[model samples]
Target: MSHGYPKEGFNLVGSWDDWKSFVPLSRSGQSGSFVARVPIRRPPGLEEFQILQGQDWAARYYPTARGEGVEGPGNAHGRNFRVTPLPSDCMQLEILWDVLGRKVTWKFLNAAEQEIQAGEKKVAAKKGAKARSAPRNQASNRGPFFLVGSWDNWKGFAEFLPFGDSFRTKVKVGLDMKRVEFQVVVARDWNRRFHPTSSGDGLAGPDVGHGLNWRAEVGGKKWLEVTWSPDRAPYVEWTFPDPADAHEAAAEDFAAMLRDLAKEGSGAWFRGMAGIFEALPKCQRSSPYGAKAENEATARCLLATFLRDLETMADPRGPAPGGQRGALKELEEQCEQLLKDTVGEIDYATAGGDFMQEALPVDPATGPVQLKLWHRLVYLPLVMYVRNTVHLYEMLERLKAQSSGAGRGRLRALLDAKGTARESPYSWLVFSIVGALQILYHARAAAEKRGGCDAFPLELLASSPPQTVWIQDGVEWSPSHGSGAGAFQRKQVVNCEPMKPLGTLRKGDGLMYRGIWLPADADEDTIRYQYSFQSFSRSIEGVMRVLRFYSGVASTKAGEAARAGHILMYIGVKFQGWRLAMASWQ
Candidate 1:
């Protein structure tokens, strides 16, 4: 696998593009055109040959095309090729390349990160995998959540759901999903056009120029001709060996059936709920007979209607309820109409309206976090995901402080002496940086690997979301600033909540330790107002990021053992509490 980035040590050209090719030019004793003929140990063939400046390529005729073109004995090693360089202003390049000389072999490894991920998913699906499920910090509960394979056995698409959600997601059953698998390997940038007659000397015969790309057998047969490129990006180019439109129409029909089945399921659930409402055992026992009977009758009717719809839709592949196939068109129109009417009747509040006002004023804490500004400045910065990246450096710093004699021994603070400086743990994230480095080093062996840049775009956001909530009207939600007419008295923050006070999120200033800074006369209704990013956890997070990037250690990256070490060393140092070093950047 290749390493990521164009940095020294691991990079081929280390820190820059555009290599300087050194060529020694020799002038013949008598020259008409002053030709600078660069001697060739072996012909560069078409791939490495390019006509730049005043240069040209042609056949240096061979008599028998064997043993330097000599017909007689001692001629098994036949013809040789040379690059013709002429006099002109353009830069002329000539080269005799081999594994040794100025040539650095570069090999590009496969770039698909999905391979390892798929493997992990399969491992997680095992009957008894040792993976532990971590608790989620999510606040809301409703979800289209299902776990396939991830942290805490999390899997599937979970973008809408934050990392803070639950410890685990429900298991959605269907399709025997765990068993479905597909693997593809694409050998990109390899020479697809090389003749078997050219190469010799235990090297690839001319056709060997393409070299060993890679192979993936799908369905137990070799999948061939899959393509990849510098211009188009590598991808599995399997030509759907099955056939064009093979079962596509049937697949679409099946999908439609599945959708109908889901709707039926929902209908069944609602109908059953109606039955429960109609037969409220408590109501039947406590309420009058007439009222009980009336409620029961209404519930039964609702339940019956639902059951009828359910029965009609059973075996989703069947016809419509009214025996009118293709009634979906009319039903869609009716549904659209109902949506429009319902929307028309709805009265959503406009921005800056009176309801937007907070119902109760924030009780001025004898502490901080009273105003919206405070929440934004102090609290919002606190909830940072302590990852081993440049993203959360500053917040990590704050987490270390927030007490008397703070900043003594947070893991990062201690690591400042031991940790690296100003670079991501690219070496630590092996899967992320491995392929590019391999390409950087092995470019010569494989004809397809030459002359390409290694830098790639980052996969995740530069930073995490805000931790503390920022608001002006606390008791109720509002859009307007404070002091509005007919507006209810409210503090910026209804509450001064704390996630982890001393854990991080502090101004580099010991002054913030002035503790909330509420006025002497400040009461429950007093609004707390903070004013600077210096007070934010974001700043601390920033510092931590720089530290992580610099360290580049693999084992110590955001792992639990690593985290415990950080906290132990940090709190132990600062608070003089306890000292324990769990993990190091290995």
Candidate 2:
């Protein structure tokens, strides 16, 4: 509506001119109304138009509410006005401005001067009587509106009944449907349908059919309450069935039971995986320690047996009793064949070199090669388990990232560790226990392959024994041993009961222990084993250096050639002649 703009400024912009040209509106004499006459040749069903002031969009007249013949924005905003012209040869449109609202109230008339459609109806009330609203049950003058959508395969329609100046109807809607697209139409005609102005609500853009249908999410509701009126656009609301209806209640109960069962099944699968990881080490230990020679005859077959058992336990059917399952039996057989055909004929160092170089079987070029007992059973199985475990951890990290609300908080609490431990201790324990089994298997296999001479002492492989020390009043008796360890525990404090690693145990000690050590004043050492890969790597490197030098020296002896060979194989490297240098010893 033009507030104070000149009447000559108002012009009609419509689809008849492709909305590119504005047709000037002439001022009606003395009525202060602006009018535009549609020529007899201009045929119309529904015509889109807008009234602009001074031919500028910034001053265009938009309808704040839909009136009788004009369809304004319904459930949408910033939409052009649309109206259906009567079948008459010519029609005239008159507009009155609402200055405060900056909108237009319009009416169209046929040549007979009879009103066709009015934007709003003005009611006259008696002077001494109470004002009354228009009749609610009266149907629209145009035609009955019908509701159509995927609910009925888009074949049929549900007629809307007038209710308090608006049309409404109830239709059955399934909660499981992913999309429920529908529209309001007059007499069930596609040519006279209503659609949402916003395209993002599961609707296509202007290039599609007549327009995009209105979409509803349904969202676990049995019935949808659809409504349409002049003032507001067509929209839907959820309408649940009566709670006392036994059939409806039974359906809801069944759905809830299904949800609970699904949750239980998922939980069981996760717990089963955790149990499998926990049992892997114990299963390896239960196999006779070094009796593979008598049963399998070769280290290769013995290692294959271990791999078969490991994969069998992870099968969905359940943990295998002890040996091979059908899942990976063929792969296990191939590993045995490959090792037996290649091990003694080729350089054994090549097998060890490949295994160490590709700790993971990620390189496609070398992944299928299994030439030694270590490669087939020890390294391959360990790497496979580690890789799969990493995948599971990655999935858990993604779940943690996407999780929100109470569920996210609970998941975070379950996955995260408290205090200094950044991650769950159980996760670390799985890796440590699995690595230990592989180490033991490798040692036993290597020794057997070298005729039982290529064996290293347990003390050489393990960490330094924790030395006993004492503390009083938060002061250590032997700080010189170095308290660089990650943690410690107090066995006894003079007359006090034994305490956990707390306050003084962490502050007073200077030496990091391989395990819990007893106080110097205690009756005996209370060893608590705790080890890591970093410690083992350092220890093994030193032992290899010493064994290499000794092997070189022993090679010169009269009948010690076999002993020297075993020594070289055990350390997995050759002595490049000892050099006298400060860095070499360090």
Give per-residue lDDT, candidate 2, residue 500.
Answer: 25
Please write out the lDDT profile of model 2 over residues 1-586, one tens digit for every residue.
Answer: 3445565467666654345445556555534555554322133345666777666666666554554233222223355676654343223444454433444555665434356553333232211110112222322223346678887788756665433335555566665886687766654446555544453332111122354566667667655656555322223332334323523343344344334333443233234233333343322212111111122212233233333333333344533321223313333444445445533232334223332223222212223323444443334444333332322222222222111111222222322221111123223223323433645555446544764432322222222111223332455523223333233223331211221221232233222211111222111111111111211122345555434432322101211222423321111121123222111111
How displaced is residue 356 in candidate 1, in Å? Answer: 17
lDDT of each: 0.22, 0.37
* Poorest stretch of ten by lDDT in candidate 1: 9-18
CA shift at 30, candidate 2, in angstroms?
37
In Å, residue 508's CA in model 2 sits off its true spot by 99
Model 2, residue 540: C-alpha shift (Å): 99
Regions more than 4 Å wrong, model 1 = 1-475, 478-488, 492-586
Model 1 quality (TM-score): 0.14
Off by over 4 Å in 2: 1-142, 201-211, 232-586
**Best of the candidates, lDDT:** 2
